[model samples]
Target: MRSFVYARPETIDGAVSEMTAEPGAAYLAGGTTQVDLMKDEVLRPVRLVDITRLPLREVWSDGDALVVGALVSMEELAGHPVVTERLPLLREALLMGATPQLRHMATMGGNLLQRTRCRYFRDPSVPCNKREPGAGCGAIDGFHRTHAVLGTSAHCIATHPSDAAVALLALGAEVRVRGGEGERVVPLTDFYRLPGSTPHVETVLEHGELITHLEIPLLPRGARSGYLKVRDRASYEFALASVAAALVVEDGTIRRAHLALGGLGTVPWRVPRAEELLRDAAPGEESFAAAADAALAGAVARPDNGFKIELGRRAVVRMLSTLAKES
Candidate 1:
């Protein structure tokens, strides 16, 4: 690993300042993902600004929404009373993301900002557009079974590997960021950038911008929500296809539904067409299958990963069916 200067900032402004002062500086919270990248030489920062000391670890309910500080650990969030009672989908996603040890150390902001788990991107020896722009993506035609099918580009096919992020996207979470220019609130849907041409640019966050907190709008009183993950293993593995779903069933008819997919797209994939199809429809196999089809309508898959298209549809149907039955 490359040696770098380290600074522990007590304030958000101090952290941002420290990051901006050095062009090759990165903010460190849990260091779960950052440390791994640094060890792999995939990310070589000249300076590391430790923001764990910053006062961004609170998790509270604000009016009808939940406001979670960026530094809150995944394990803590998963077990928090407010989260369990109000946002069960988020809790389930958090718990299923990693092992207990990793969940204890992974922070909310860090999870959302974590890079893709593509082998080509993580290994310095391989060419990856996300790791080094214009070098070419080695996974495009080589061992891309775990890569993305939706929101993919000719330059990159890496899947965004955050289960929590998929739940947050379905919940309509908003991110609060503080940077050199000051503070701003960005919708989670708009936070991620598609890997069209500039695959290296992943998010809307500018250099030295620090995510402070996340605001998730609470579900309706009668709404039921859950998360389902399918992977190679039962535990401590990334999802091959996952679904985060919330449904409000009133008098045997679905009134509102929100669905987001993970492990199948370049970003946390939200399917509005599927959600729309579920609205006012009865919770049955026909409706569920139709919604699933709508969700995977524009998916483009490669040879190895084409199964994900069907798997993603089944996940959507299964999650919605379960939530509908519970509601």
Candidate 2:
């Protein structure tokens, strides 16, 4: 591993100032993903600013919105009564993601900030535009079975790898950030960026910004929600395709819907069209199929990941059906 300077900040302002003072410094939380990447030479920060010591861990209900601190671990969020009861989709997504041990250690902020799982980015030998701009994307003509089908550009096809993020997007949560500015809230849907010219920049977060917490606005009570993941394995694997849906079906008609897809795009893919289709449709196979079709209508697929378009649709359909039954 590369030798790097390390510092732990007790205050958020100190951490932000330290990071802003250094161009190539990263905030370290669990170090579960960042450490491995450093060893592989995928990432080599000049300084590691430890932020786990900062007091950002908390989970509470603020009126109708459920607030979860960035330092809160997946295990803590998943097991929280407020999370499980009010946002079952989030708990379901967390349960389907990483192993129990990792989940216990992984922070929510770290998970949202995790980098893409693209092979080209991880391997120094490969030519990836994301890792080295102007080098060209290796996945373009190589193995891309796990690549993106939406929001992809010539520069990159790498997809985001967080199931929890998808659920967060579907729930219409907002992320609270602190940086050079005092504090600001960014809608979760707007936090992630599409793989445009700069695939390296996965999020809209500024250089020294620290994610403080996330707030999930309340929807209809007892909302029917579910998260479905399709992967190469049943457990301990990255998603091939996944859908997280929160639906309110009442009197045999859809009242409202929130839809977000994973493993198919550069970010947590929100399908406004799918939500529109489910808005007033009856909970049935035709309705679900229509919503799925609307969600993937204009997806541009690569050679190896064309099947993802169908897989994503089916996953959405299955999740909607399951949630509908529960409703």
Candidate 3:
């Protein structure tokens, strides 16, 4: 790895000041993904400002919402009683992600900022528009079985690789970020950006800003929620397609539903069309099928990932069907 200046800031202001002063400086949380990327030379920071001791590690309930500290590790979240009880979908997503050892070292903020596992984007030899602006995307004609099928531009088709993000979007989670200006709240759905001309810019986070914590709004009691991921392997692999669903069926009719898809978009693709279709519709094969169809109405598929369109639909149907049966 290339040598870089390092600073351990005890306060948020000190960390922000150091990060702002140093161009190409990155905040170090758990250092799981950052260190690996640096080793691979995919990321080279001029300075590394350590924020692990900046008093951001904490989790608590704010009356109706679950507030998760940014520095909280995936392992801590998965094992937390409140998280497992209140946000089972998030817990399941994290459990199915990286192994125990890595999860213990992966913080929530780092997980959200983690880049795609696209071969072309990771390897310097391969041409990738995301890695190098207008360099052209090799994944378009190369191995792209795991690429995105929705919200993809001709410039790039790489998919976001966070299962936790999918569940967070479904649960109406909000992110709290601190910058040189101050703190601000951004919805989880709006956090990630669609790959337009600039696929390299993946999120709405401004430079020198730091994610502080996550806030998950209170969902109705007795609501069923879950995450389903389909991959080439059963475990320790990224998703070929995935769905995060939360539904509330009342007297055989769907009263409320939240549906979001991952592994198929540049961002966590929330399906308002599906949500609208499921509203007041009976929880049955026909209704679930209709909702699934509505969800993919705007999907634009690539040559290799067209299968994801159907895979994503099947995932949504299966997840909703299972929720219906249990409810």
Candidate 4:
């Protein structure tokens, strides 16, 4: 076992202080992702600041928005009546994630912050820019079928691996965080950073900051929303291509639309072009196909992963078509 100091902080202030005091400390909630990486030695933190004991586990509401605590488990979030009724997209996304046991332990915050599942990043022997910056990316030219097609850099092409995040992004959620500077809310769409030059830096959050909660903003009432995940396996497998789609139709015209893709991009890929095409348009196969095409228009493809472009397009089209039928 690796050597590390452990601190179970009962308060948010104490958690932040412990994280700030140690330059190489990591916050531990569910340990679903952190522990796996630690076992692989991909992350070698000197200290672990456990934040599970904090009061950040409530599922409440603030007028129109739905507030979910950072420490709330995926299963809890998926099964909550509020989530099931108002945000079926999010509930479906959570249920489509890892197995029931992992979902029972995986926190909403940790799910959003989980690291990429790239083979190179998980294997210490391989050179991964995300795992060890400046070491060069092995997946760039090797075993790259699962790498990203959108929002990727020449340095790293690892795909973001969260099904729930796609739904959250599509639903226009905001991330609440506590840091040395105090509390702030960031649009979930703006929280993730593209792997440009620094593949190691995955988010806009600073070292001392902690994700406290997530809030999904109000959406059009009677909206039909859900997630569809296409994976290599039938169950308990990461998505090969997945879509989180929502639509509100009124008087034969598209009202509000929310769309995002997972397992196909460096971040939770929100396609504004697709959403733009969807807006004011009638529900039809042609519109769905066009919207899907627009979403994948600028996708860049590596050798083995080029199939994902067309696959992702089909997934988008299929998801929209299904949503249209329900509306």
Q: State each model's CA lDDT, in order.
A: 0.93, 0.90, 0.88, 0.91
**For model 1, what is the alpha-carbon lDDT of residue 148?**
92
- lDDT tens digits by residue: candidate 1, 154-264: 999999999999999999999999999999999999999999999999999999999999999999887899999999999689999999999989899989999999999
TM-score of each predicted structure versus truth: 0.99, 0.98, 0.97, 0.98
Residue 26 displacement in candidate 2 (angstroms) = 0.6
Predicted candidate 3, C-alpha RMSD: 1.1
Tens digit of per-residue lDDT, candidate 3, span 86-152? 7778898999989999999999988988988888888888788888888999988889888988888
* Order of models, best lDDT first: 1, 4, 2, 3
Off by over 4 Å in 1: none
Tell me which of candidates 2 and 3 scores higher on lDDT. Answer: 2
Candidate 4 lDDT over 1-327, as tens digits, reads: 389999998899999999999899999999988898898788999999989999988999889889999999999999998888889988898988989999999999999999998989999998998888899999987999888999998899999999999999998899999998899999998999999989899999999899999998766678888799988888888888999999998887788789999999999999988899999999888889999999898899988999999999999988888877883
Which residues of candidate 4, in runs, are more than 4 Å off?
none
How displaced is residue 230 in candidate 3, in Å? 0.8
- Report the candidate with higher lDDT, 1 versus 2: 1
For the record, the alpha-carbon RMSD of candidate 2 to the native fold, in angstroms, is 1.0
